[model samples]
Target: MSILNSFLIKTSSVKKICISFFASQFTLLIMMLYTFPIINSQIGTRAFDLQNLGYSLSTANQIVNNLNNQTTELYLFPQLTLLDVFYPFLLALFLSSLLFRLGKLIGKDNKITSLLLYLPLLAMAFDYFENICIILMISKSIEISKSFVLLSSTFTVLKSLLTTFSWIVILIYTIKWVRLKIMKKATKSSLSQS
Candidate 1:
């Protein structure tokens, strides 16, 4: 926890935050515009990771079964190894940095804020675990356990919830920060006029 707090505080600069935000956006654009479409078209449905509401074991089996040679190849290589790997990490960094900065601006940089900053990181970790479960499911040698499927679905649900909650927190802090800046400006203007 101390390590995480130190890392967050160290990386919460405007420059790092902006870079991570744009990089995450660019990666998402690539996934949405290119990778996801191809994979979905090949599989004839949304990928497991995209199933924000989570998937049942039967649905998971169905999706895995639908993976043709090309789709499986794509999913294993670029989808899981490259795009998904980077997207979660970059997004977590951006969100965590932004939240830390916003908390500082609003003068709420305390224990609660520190804990809230963990949301994105937790989401990212869950996403990685979900991907590992997916890889295991995709492998021919490995017997797909009902437990693994359940765990994957659980991780997916958690990732979605944490990510959503983090964004909501960021939005709330952003509104407060904007209001604070405006009030400061208004006070300055009144003093200048007087």
Candidate 2:
């Protein structure tokens, strides 16, 4: 109950809205993981191998598809097109900020905001690692060694979840901001009392 009160009362000095956004985004990522397979199953096998290549996986395909009249003989799967609009670096930053806001709402300003700041860096690293995987997969230069289908699926789901979580965090941050702004006059008066 005390914890709930802290979240709802809007009495803190910190940037509560920003914190709320961060927390929400993290949760959203988890939820996205649970849901994306249902939404973009066409990528199927390719989605797994392509996950590391960032938005390039989908965008590169679009370039290929446009260049040729029909199937240009590359069988790398077309559904990577699903990610053409969602550039991974930009998406990771946006989602991180959103998650930061969510964390603020629940009185977790410092840690959440710090995480938000760092996630982009991590996203970059993770993305690069995934890209290496994609390259290896593409050239047949290296054997996957494990269950290709299941392994790729697992990674795809996790990646998608992380992306979704970013958006959720931002939404939560926005919510907290609105709540505080609506109560600004009262908040000011209370501060004057202290």
Which prediction has the highest TM-score against the true structure?
1
| Stretches of candidate 1 exceeding 4 Å from the true structure | none
Query: TM-scores across all candidates?
Result: 0.93, 0.45
Structure candidate 1, residue pairs in collision? none
TM-score of predicted structure 1: 0.93
Candidate 1: tens digits of C-alpha lDDT, residues 47-80: 8889988888787778878888887888888888
Local error of candidate 2 at residue 117 (angstroms)? 4.0
- Candidate 2: misplaced stretches above 4 Å? 1-86, 97-108, 119-124, 147-152, 185-194
Q: Kindly list the per-residue Cα lDDT of model 2 for residues 70-145, writing each as its tens digit.
A: 2221222221222321335444544454454456564656644555545543554454445445445544556544
The CA root-mean-square deviation of candidate 1, after full C-alpha superposition on the true structure, stands at: 1.6
